[model samples]
Target: MSEKPLESFVGVVGKETWWSRIEALEAAAAEGRRCGWAARQRHAIELTIARLLRAPARAPNAAESEIVHLAGLLAASFRGLAAKGKAALHASLHAALSGDGALTPIFHQMRVAERHRRRGFSVSFAGLETGAAFDLAISRNGARAEIVCDVLSAEDGREVSRQAWRQLADRVDPDLHAWLAAHPGRYLLKMTLPQGLRADGGGENASPAHLQARIRTLLAGDARAQQDETAVLRLDPLVLAGTDTSQHGLLAQLRGDFGPEAHLSVTVAGQGVFVMAARAAREDDVGTALRRRLAALSGARLSGAAPGVLAMFLEDTDLAEWRGLRETLRLEGAARGFLAGAEARPVAAVSCATRAELIGLPVPQSAAGGEVRFANPAHPAARSPELAAAIRSAE
Candidate 1:
């Protein structure tokens, strides 16, 4: 806190060293003529460093602290690990910067471990050391608990995937603009995908290309509507009953009508407009997916030698839906249901962390008290003072 945040950060992890590495990755991506995750991540980290340097000479905020935290954590991991352990960590580290993977999963584990360490527990990457399946081992006052930190995307519960929608939108955008230009009329395309619009499909499943072609075909026809086993597509006049006609207003209106589960996009070309709204046949319960992950983790990740903790990091979740889950108690319901199941035998508690929390703002932090915890009172470790920081429930 004494020195400037950026200066202190550079000391923690040599800025030139990492900056050059990221730049090299960026250069490779540029030479390949591809803008992918690696390039994007490199840009993001650069922006973080820039922001930190530009911050006023005051107390550091979430983003500043996060950049520093990542630098220090990564530097330490690189220095401390070796051989198979380092190799395993490298795989994740590479994905953390490249590929279609993300850093949230790795960062979530570190934050959870930090919390335990602050509570006076000796924490280590247990799986890296013992080749165990679980992530971290934390012990306090001789009582140890196994903590498994896992990230689950809300998209996993969707009948429609985000990537599929993105691809579909990209595929149809130019065609829609051309069509809209020729037609010069307000238009809307409503869709129902029983099999779901898939980004990756070689079978009868609805592929983005197939769906895009189908929409084009419908636009070419005078029928303005078509229905089949794969999907139902209808073209109609765009109407916003009482809203403004601007692009922003139209998109907002469509989003409201389609709801959070729907994927909607609007295209405008010289006043000829088109809006596409689509949804899968049924909405998948996000809470159910969380429970499914919990069930899967118990068998695959946990060793069952100690009372285990499941630290759930709900990734790719927006604030609106995040609030909806907690308000409707969907998260609570799913977590409790998992705890009641046989899969929970070795699990002592389930705690949830959100992007907001990981970014340093623990929204609601929950009135249930310290960390959204569901303690398994029946587990022997539940009463252990040492484990209390982790397994004790505010409930």
Candidate 2:
């Protein structure tokens, strides 16, 4: 056994071999319940990490990629860390490879790209850094209309989007207010609020009627909040789509306002997903936010799930931020502290710009029938196992 190569052992493993190895190790540890058993498991995990670090620094093919991901998964199971611990481990691996070359920090780059994914006028408020901007686009039968408003203040808070807009009023620059007032009939003020805000009791408080009522009351009771002319600013429910039934309200209002002729599109940035909808004929830009969000989530989910094998997927990755990873990991003779007898972990990850690249990474099947066992359910690739299999079979 000691004379044979590591790849020789791993490469010959059958479908159940990886999981069986993990289960046997775990059962042994549980049966003995001894400190020595736990210690041995830890040592094995450390040894595995060392082997991975010392492995030749070349772009791995599909088989080698499977080995890395499997190795990481097996090591992680041996350590018996919880989900949060696994998350930290996943994060640390990426961090180690971050400064090596042109590699982008996986999470950081996803966030930046996610911020810019929307297709509309991006509005930044004065004084505040341009974080993520809310995108709202309205199209009539005739033309497309867009407006960029700097978010001055959402209820006087620095982070306008995070606060509950119950009794709050956003103080924008006078110019923004003046511009909206000028187009009272066409452009109306719609104060955006964070989603998932629960009431004291927690059910239906975040509903559309409740939110609309709150917005109305806030604007009415505050003498200074009202504009000189318009009574209530138009409510763009597309902006509120994912925030419970509030989106339905927006849809109803949109139908009433636009009738059968005009089209309205709204996209609100949510965590990892974008809430987007279109009425009437759709345009090419409609799916921009959703596509970007999917790509970002897929990259994040894949990296967190399997950091060891993540390096295998970086060959086609853009080198702008990922070059450092290759440089660091490929360094010759550097004392890999954790890789030398000490317990080691995986490194950071790279990103892909498209769904095909993300879903095309090698996946371990649970059965000979080709059922994918180790992908995020939300991943677009996981949605159609047949298609994924066909694609892989072709490759």
Candidate 3:
């Protein structure tokens, strides 16, 4: 009996040689097969080729020779295709050879498409130390867009410049409605910080509620322009704001309106709120206590009188101590009480987990007319010794 050359070849290549043996098996399957078998063999070969071609170069111990062999096989499969198939094969080859890193280029091309869809235009406004400037542009095919520049330093100047740029950009692409429709809503709302201004904590100075309010304002404008009847303004305070007492309060309010099990994180300084909660809690489930405290102060008002504040009118010592007494809340956490001041004395005072909670309480009025009073109404200096101890310890 004469030996089969392909079978002999496969025996030499061993099962451990996956790439070489796969080729041998494919060649064997193609020889003297029925029409259906031939088609199945071809399909299997094509899929194997694709899988090999798409394998990332970052894979450990991958051989260059194996990759080249796979690429050659794929090229042979598409050598005589018509224009559409050829174009698709070319794009696939480009994507496969470039590996996962090719996504960046793909994204850039999508961005170009997005720009073109908006009547070939884009704009960026960057705030500078001295002032802010708008760079308007008209996109040219396969080239850098042309820029129309304007700068503004004074508050008045910035507003006028912003308005002018808005008018121009609108004429180019009515409110960039097409562009916005293509991108995620959150991306449009992100506030990009200017260089050097990051030292001010990159909008950390704005409370979560404040940031949400700003986003609501912008989204409202977009909705009005689009005349979107079904466009509902969904403000997610927990996601927008860093984890602080204010964020906690906002989350509580949202939960009250929405429901529990809301998968949200309120952050402070861009750090995860879980860390803040962990630091503040004496146990694993202190988050429940924190949420309850936030819910308790849901209707508290803001005063805007101080750089930071944490005002609460709790009758319970445990609630007051747990919510009202933190040494340093992140700027967002503290800004909740920026305007709150008191005309009457606080019944008690103590530091809590975040400064943002202070905004929920009324400022204490002083009996001495200027001195801040910190006696619990139940204890009032003449009453309870434990209250005095708690007050002394707080001081």
Candidate 4:
């Protein structure tokens, strides 16, 4: 080979690298801050694929640590896709894994590990497809292992999805529902918009009618619109209100539910479930405890325009005591300002024996008081399978 020909080829190869496309995508995504999560994730997937292809070309045999890290990253990205509801990517990944011998099992393994909240995995790569002329083999610990491109972190992906939902809530200003309740005179909605009308207006130009329209659209889209709308009407303690009408899965898994020293967590639904953990000394004590627990259980952050249903789980032995306690607690809640609206707070208090009993609890027979009503949660398990499994495992 002539030295001149070899030098020209080296320059051409260096100039036309695969990473340039990824760089352009990254820059464009950065330029558009308001771009949706779906757009951002597409760029991420492409960038990751470019990086993976580069890895095999630079060195076919990568360190186990390097492979693990890469695999973990890719797994996270896959999770991000899942979180975004991008079924196409999932289908593609499965198709790629099953049909093409270009990728290894490490991608699937890493995804499994992330789902289970594991740190490391034993990985091997049989073939790494780069679309180049040569087929590459990746090894770990003197064995064949392939490390393909990784996606986002599974945990991070969840956070991203959460943030997206939060953004959507903020854009429509769901908190304004509480504000509207407080200042009804400020923005009067004299004309009622048609049902199924969603809010589209924003800024100072937007009237109260527009805001109401938006709230209506958002609530209507929600599966639990009726319940949430009721809670929004009584939004005095805005910070303590349960904004998230979505299922909480198991309340027991979260450490933030209890005090730092306490190791107890009750697996309540997202709407919130309050267990009569320890009996109170006096009639007044249960009210005090209920208030404190309600505040603790319903996080300060408002996810929507609703107060979480504060259900009290009770055993057969405590029925009579709880019956008397319920009235006293309800009275105390009203007096103490924990319960509000035409609906009685205590009336809404659902009594159940166990989590299983909570699954198919019927609606209260009598609409006796303006008490908050409790019903069976639409979804008992968490949104993510891994998280749902963890909750079940804890139980």
Candidate 5:
């Protein structure tokens, strides 16, 4: 018999091994329970072991195997803690793994799922400075999307009294209203109030639909508030067109609206627009407000952008603002690259001009520079002879 290296198990039966490991731990727990350990001790051991065995192997390394062994020891320790009725240790472990204070458990779950397949529904939201927990999730099949919103209190006070909630709602409403107004022919606006958070009787009465309705109503009101704030200013469209394209149009537009001192750039690769204003301008506040507005307009299709940054996909239906902005930037010299789809190869290239800072360091002028060129970099675009000719012409 030969000892098998953990790396050998990397691609072969990875997920199955995790499941088997968890099952073995559970069986051990069952045996311990039958041998006179308390039920709580057995349960604690089961949970700790299950969580630890959840992650798939990232590489075939002895160190990783050692970590798994340590996790097993940790699970056994939990059994002893439970038997001693050490509330503090139990709480600490729970906090370290899952509860409010612990994120390790969630990370472990995500790592395990990644080995099986790409996540389909995972999303992450930024936390409010006001102490609200951000939400991140991986659905049963692993798809992911993240939403960042202000925290609302369900306990005691009036719903409207939550300042953070009101501010969040207000920031989001304008873009929602703009989007609704701009596409009235294709889109419908609907609003509904949710059932009260507190159930009149007992048991959880909040259905998914009810929660969704509440979100809609909050957004509707917020849009109205945004309209009130910007009532005096009219939005004007910005256009960009030319052969020597760049991101100057975007910068120009931002300079015009937010002031010339504002530094604006779009990251084509990441699908994000970043804005930074000069001293004394409250850039963070401006960025937050703008992000909320863009998010509302995009129907939350946009994922989380960094603070003072806004992000949206080029395929969004309500992309007129973004299109107009991107075009202006194109005329101003922003390096742009187009990919066929989310996983497709690049189809077009724009000279890196938008924000030189945001683009990757320029490709070396010669292959001798020790640079590795992308395999099949020309595939998606080369299929179009005219486009391939254009790329060559630019070079």
Candidate 6:
């Protein structure tokens, strides 16, 4: 290994051994001079490497934690493909760089694979090479287990998606700034999306455009509140009796104030401030989405020849919602329920990891001990000590 940390890291990324593929990944990002999530991730990794090249070796600081985790993740993920799984690598890198949230599934697969490997299993991307529906193959002793990795979004069970809320927020930013300027006072806009908010709205009232129009009407008119079948919008004094200025501190406060399930954003102009918060009439059922996804992928991805592991990654979740699911046993209930269903016959184990595990947070910050996994006791291989490390439940 090179004494230079950057050189060492780059080497681990196979910058020398896998330069052609690296160029291919870069080429995919370079099409028409395009830049997206993958491009940004690439840039971030390169920037971190550059920083590593200049900085002296010392104890890892909080700032370097992201770099360390990112490097480890990429290094482990990329090396698994090597020169043999070009198609899989191409597909993954393309999706991730296209900024389409492909990183969730790809990283989920790698993260799970890493966990199994650390538990003493020899892991392979057989599915990637063979074009199988599943994503990974892990072997321990004389037994092997096939894993089908899938990702489920938390928005699936909601009447109003977070993505839609984000689009609405962006669309309303200019209008909100103007409204703040005209009003010149702090305000809070609380909305209840009963019929639900959608980005396209499918040519209906649920669309962000429709919502924007409603907000515009509220801001321009004398009415302090508006309600209809689709939504309820209320404008009130922005009374955020709170204090915090450090990074993510205000956000922490805001999330604490609004709770995890609400879609929240704040816009400030000159001396005026505006806070927009919205939620569905009911709570989101992320578990229902997970169970549905399990049913959808069960037969299609599992071969049923060997004990199968369905590794699920739940995305678009916040710290609060994530914790609530576990504390409330919502996640375990969902997974165990699926394990009892007919579709779970081929599955010897079901493991779930959330966004925190995706980002590689350490213990205490991550799920205590490790990922929350459940073993199917009915499966013949579930009790094998050799396979226990891979198929057994941690919960």
Top candidate when judged by lDDT against the true structure = 1
TM-score of 6: 0.79
Off by over 4 Å in 5: 1-86, 95-99, 104-395
Where's the lowest-lDDT run of ten residues in candidate 2? 149-158
Candidate 3: RMSD to truth: 31.7
> lDDT by residue for model 4 over 1-395, one digit each (tens)?
22232223223223343244445555655642333443354333344444555564443222332333444454444444333323443444444333211122233333333422341223222122223111112222332211122211111211112223223333434344444454442221111212111223222222334434445654345433222321121111212234442224322332234322121112122333322111111122334444444344334311222212233332111223334444444524432344343222212122222111212223232113212233212323223232222222111
Measured on C-alpha atoms, candidate 4 has an lDDT of 0.30
TM-score of 3: 0.16
Give candidate 1 misplaced runs (Cα > 4 Å): 1-61, 77-88, 202-204, 222-225, 362-371
When sorted by TM-score, best at the front, the candidate numbers are 1, 6, 4, 5, 2, 3
TM-score for each prediction?
Answer: 0.83, 0.19, 0.16, 0.23, 0.21, 0.79
Q: Which is better, 2 or 3, measured by lDDT? A: 2
Report the CA-based lDDT of candidate 3 relative to the real structure: 0.28
Q: Which ten residues in a row have the lowest lDDT in candidate 1?
A: 31-40
Write out the backbone clash pairs for model 1.
Answer: none
lDDT of 5 at 361: 25
Question: Model 5, residue 360: what's the lDDT?
Answer: 17
The parts of candidate 4 lying over 4 Å away from their true place are: 1-126, 129-164, 174-214, 217-225, 228-234, 239-395
Against the true structure, what is every candidate's RMSD? 4.5, 24.2, 31.7, 22.6, 23.1, 5.5
Cα-based lDDT for every prediction: 0.74, 0.28, 0.28, 0.30, 0.28, 0.72
lDDT of 6: 0.72
Error of 6 at 58 (Å): 9.5
Supply every candidate's count of residue pairs whose N, Cα or C atoms clash at under 3 angstroms.
0, 17, 25, 21, 34, 1
